[model samples]
Target: MRDSLRFYLGDELREIRDVDPTLTVLDWLRLSERRLGTKEGCAEGDCGACTVVVGRLTEDSQGGKSVRYEAVNACIRFLATLDGCQLLTVEHLKGPDGALHPVQRALVEHHGSQCGFCTPGFVMSLFALYLNEDRPDERRIDDALAGNLCRCTGYAPIVQAARAMHDLGDRTADRFNDRAATAARLKALADEEILSVGSGDRRFLAPATSAQLAELLLGHPDATIVAGSTDVGLWVTKFQRVLSIVLYTGRVTELRRVADTGDALEIGAGATYSEAAPAIAALYPDFGELIRRIGAEQVRNMGTIGGNIANGSPIGDTPPALIAAGAALRLRRGDATRTLPLEEFFLAYGKQDRRPDEFVEAVILPKPAPGARFRAYKIAKRFDQDISAVCGAFRLSLDESGNVAGIRIAFGGMAGVPKRAAGAEAALIGQPWSEASVHAAMAALKADFTPLSDWRASAGYRAEVAANLLLRFHVETTDPATETRLVGDRRLAHA
Candidate 1:
């Protein structure tokens, strides 16, 4: 086992010892290392001023090593999580001759910086995109930059800079282009041994396998299981809570695997949203779109579906969609494993069916049957990087007679938990797929939930929007020519 955490800060290998387990990467950069380019904006993961890129070794199909670079928010990212990876900051983007990188040059030429506080973050994000993509469209650029916020300079110049990146020609000979050496370095750092860091009462344990994690959890039931730390990091930064024992899940390779069977897709509990997005999209496109809007790229890259479900927040966007799609969860405790329906896992607000020593192992999503229609809708104050006021997901199957054979409707932000609209589903089953039937189901929703009035929406507003979303679903599905979604229409027109 290694006592000290070792990682590459740019090209220099650094070893950190005896630090607090909850020390954030941003603080380590500014206070400890004196690398001041990465700024802390929100302290939380919301602002992108603290953006930085992480590169990890991945296996290519040719049985060789490669590196995958992902941009992450540094403010909420814990320093202990940097083990066995390469951390790249804005300081690493310059050449030996002091020439600005292509991303920096494009930003400079297009005047993409104003006030310059957020420029480092934008440059890092663009740098990651530049490394991954040669030429990205406007939509791709928008998605990549969604996590970054520039209050002064409007996004036009930044968008222009993103578009102009490819004109500088291929960067095959760049310093970062040689991933084989980095992959070799990362591989040498990888081991099956556990990582135990910190001192006294504050400690961090990163197990290398699911069995180790299960055993650790069984031994220390009070330890918090942290994967991605998207939500748990906020407890330290925003709420000023001290975590004593953090059992990190990022090192558990078994928990990070995603398997696709012909009948269903099984996503590991530790898989990040970025890892699960393509598989989720292949299974259900609407659910994919919903996942894309859950948070910005940084959040998606650092947040896991398992953590999202395990946290069991009432406003979480994925639960309603998963419940409606008839998803199930696999949980493990010690040597025992159990499965339960996804909706049943959520007992109430700030509560769930998870046991103290047990942890979620995987999420099993059944494939959509033929003649089935699925749709998920999220209503929020802003279109991107915002929490949903109300999230609705519907999966309806039609019989050969053109009637509603079966239906599952679930909603979040409507009740204490992500729950199914049983009354509404009961009203729609065996009924024809028409406006009248949808109205009956919508009316039945009144009995299903009495939503509370919050700052995001009033009780009456949620009720109305819930029913209207169902109506909109019915109209759009029933009429092939109806363009009910304004966002879809606009995106299509732009395309």
Candidate 2:
């Protein structure tokens, strides 16, 4: 069966399969559908101008929640991957009898718009904020909208508008729950095969089964695997990569599940970070902020945790965290499958230890010790959406006497691939959590790595910071009295 685009547009549900898989949602919204509310400021995912609301089916404890809305940048999002989801635009933010949405009214009253071009995207982004959770903190608001960049009106009034959304307190009164209607339509749509779009050179293919997917890929090995297209979409808008053979994974349900076992937590490769993150964050609170900063709520909602892992960018926020947790990958081909450590999966720069015919199916993460101490840190130019200069994840277990029992330290943006600080780990393995031991282990920094002198940070700076971060971790965990929790103290008790 063929996959199709299923989303909400104003009062009606839109089913779109008329464009190539490589085409971005921004183009579809503006050109094909003529929905101008979603703007394109920076073609890349950076600027939030192409923000649009995407509605996804959620599984609630009660049963199933249909079409939950979120604001995402349409610019770097592939249109074909939106199958079995709902997409909303600013024009649809209405209550019964033409009542204005809270975000719209608040923005209007606060004069949050100066150029008016950015207003629609900002409003939609805020509306997604309004729908997902109520009474978000300042940090949450900033993180939720960080992908969006605006020049006019600064951010004060816009921030004011974000806060006002909570007080209105109404739960989308006019928002209809067309669960049966939407789900049935989507069900009917996905129950077809050999789906193709466009008449001329522009075309897309969304195969239903992995076999069919592989067959298409065999013919077009250069075909793009567009699950969420968060990164690849950037290639088109930012770099203008003309993708010829595009494959959509949203139709392949085999790659979108999360499962738990006694030994490991198994997550499908196509499972979005939004879907897989909460479970992971629960297991490791140290990664809460990291997952939230993976992108905005929209990107998280649209992007997959496995996609982030598969993309294998040094700046990817999830890889360090996963490596720290001792995650493994499940790869599959036409009929055979295999599993391997995720660390071994990355061979080198722009390379993976993957078979040409095999693609990642899922990732299995071993459960950490209940008493183990954990931390993941991303040092970037900006707190969100910015590439990391040095990303670190530290996991430590201590003996009763405060001697290190076991340790795993992983760093991203420090080498050609995400690497473990083997020297640092060896230094702390048998040593007590004493200052002198930590000081001695700092010497391992030189042996472990010689980081690149990138624009993010100098090589010497990276080495110093990496060493000190370990010492700081030791102090906080082993001797709280020695660590100053205060920010101004500058005693540096963080990693």
List runs of model 2 lying over 4 Å from the truth: 1-8, 13-18, 62-65, 94-99, 166-169, 176-181, 192-194, 198-203, 209-220, 481-495
- Number of the top candidate by TM-score? 1
TM-score of 2: 0.90
Candidate 1 per-residue lDDT, tens place, 219-314, comes to 889998899999999999999999999999998876766787788999999989988888888878888888989789999998999999999999
Q: Which stretches of candidate 1 lie over 4 Å from their true place?
A: 59-65, 483-495
Model 2 lDDT per residue over 1-495, tens place = 443455555546666655665778889878987878788787877778888877665556565545556677788887766666677788777766798888888887888889888888888788877876778888678767777778877788888889887676574443534445655555544544756664365557777667777676666666667787888887887787887766777666667777778878888888887778777777776676577766666678678877787787866778887888888888877677888887888888788887665677889988778788777777776656677788888888888887988888888887878888888788888888778877877787678886889778998888888887777777667765743354221223433
lDDT of each: 0.90, 0.74
As a TM-score, model 1 comes out at 0.97
Cα RMSD of all models vs. native, in order, equals: 1.8, 3.3
24 in model 1: Cα distance from truth in Å? 0.5
Candidate 1 lDDT score at position 28: 94
